[model samples]
Target: MVEQLSRREGDCFLLTPNRSMSWKGNIRIWLAAFILSMLISTGMLLVGAWPVLPFAGLELTALAAGFYYTSRKCQKREVLTFSQELIRLEKGLTHKEKEWELPRQYTRVWQDVPRHPWTPPKLHLQFRGEEISLAPFLNIDDTEELVAILEKKGLRVEKRRRPEKLWF
Candidate 1:
């Protein structure tokens, strides 16, 4: 998820990951799904199909595991702030966070594309031989959009080479 927090005259760019669903909503949905599954499992048990009860329990476990993993991933986020004087990148969740700051004049934006077509490109900020990756989860289109935003913010954007096409 990508969102433009604010776009003002002085404020160059503010990029933040979009949170589509709230944690409360996720909990509600998970509870509803769990209850429905339990109801189905009870019906199967009443019908003399004892084997279905164990399978249903396994299904519930899998569903709970899936929800747990998804919620954890959703908690991670990246925030990029670019202004005239400073360029900042903040990543990770609340408990564990990493931040980097560089002068806007010396920072250069570029995309590192993989040789394989299947792999997604990564947006990077390079300054004085140090490189920091910006948006690793974004797709090709979102990466391009971010580059455009950076360019608009007066940062030097290195043009990426077009990938070679393979014909079967």
Candidate 2:
């Protein structure tokens, strides 16, 4: 998702991965699945097919772990603030945080495309010989859209390089 905050001095762009399911919704779904699995496993156990019980428990455990990790990742965010004199990039999750502030004139946004056609391109900011990747979770289309928006807002945008083909 992309959001713009307008200020008297400049603009702030907030970007986050789109999450179809909230943590609460995920928990509800998990609970429903757990109950259904337990019911089926208990029925099988009563019918003398008891081995299904342990497998059902293991399946639920794995599902819970997967949901936990996904929800954690969904909480991460990237914030870009562009003012007259400075541009700031802030990205992090709950446990760790990173921030960079650079002179607006010295920063340039570019797309970094891998040599392979199958790999997706990435958005990056280059400043004073240091390059920082932005919005790693965004898909290629979304990254392109973001680059367009940044360009429209007066930020310098470098074009993606053409991928090279190899003939053997």
Candidate 3:
């Protein structure tokens, strides 16, 4: 089913549920991420000797920021839509929302699906004239479907020469 929804507080559109994606996969990965973040944060707290507290505090804060950003990014249940001139995506937590903009002329969309049951598909979009990837959380199918739709709408999509490493 093709459903279109307006982004809550933006002049953007969201297209979703061409088919329901596997939330089990998304959940497992998020669980792993939470555990990994906790483990690293705890390890830093325990082993970082002399400057321990302060350093650990910083590390924990960074982790919190990362988690907050990630959760905020994932809160929405929609994939964004755009035309050839502009692209916008909505993400963030319950009350605080964030949006990102990419001029279509300066962005490239890349799609990759790894071989892991819990690994959701990812779409890596690079902006800054290909120097930085602005957003990279979109799952594989979402990426492909969105790309196809956008391509049909005449947006430029490019294939990456190499896979972009997603380190979150």
Candidate 4:
């Protein structure tokens, strides 16, 4: 999602991945699954199916790990600050892990055409000779919104319009 930040100097925008479920939500889901797995494992153990017990434990462990990693990824975000002289991009989860400072005039926002209709065009910042990816987690609508917002900030290179289809 794209959010505007109040800054006395210049424009600031916060970019975050769309999260269907939060950390707490993920934890709740994991807990429920763990309970179900334990109940089934315990039942199988009573029937002399001891192998299922270990497999269930391993499955629950893998599920927990997958949920944890995904929740962490969802926490990641990027902050873009466009001041008069410099354009600063900060990326991190909870804290600033990486940052890039480029000249405002040298930074340009561009995108490549999407291969699929449902997918949004991938946005990138052209700085000198390098291409820096921006908001790769955004969906179709949010990606277009970000492009529009960047265009208002005079950072957009070209516009890509969505095709209209009347047939459902």
On TM-score, the leading prediction is: 4
* Root mean square deviation (Cα) for candidate 1: 4.5
Q: Alpha carbon lDDT of residue 98, candidate 2?
A: 92
* Tens-place lDDT digits, model 1, residues 1-168: 567666552453434445567778878887898888889888888898879878878887888787777777767677777666888787886543888888988888887766777776787889899988887877666777887788778887775765677976
Residue 144, model 3: Cα distance from true site in angstroms:
3.1
lDDT of 4 by residue, 79-100 (tens): 9898989888999999999899
Locate the minimum summed-lDDT window of 10 residues in model 3.
Answer: 12-21
Clashing pairs in 2: none
Alpha-carbon lDDT of model 3: 0.55
- Sort by lDDT, best first: 4, 2, 1, 3
Q: TM-score of predicted model 1?
A: 0.74
In model 2, what lDDT does residue 50 have? 94
Best-fitting candidate, scored by lDDT: 4
- For model 2, residues 79-167, the per-residue Cα lDDT tens digits are 88888889888898763399999888878888776676666578888888998988888766677778878888678777687566687
Pairs in clash, predicted candidate 1: none
RMSD in Å for model 3: 10.5
Off by over 4 Å in 3: 6-12, 15-74, 77-84, 113-120, 129-141, 161-168
Please state the error at residue 29 of candidate 1 in Å.
2.7
lDDT of the candidates, in the order given: 0.75, 0.85, 0.55, 0.86
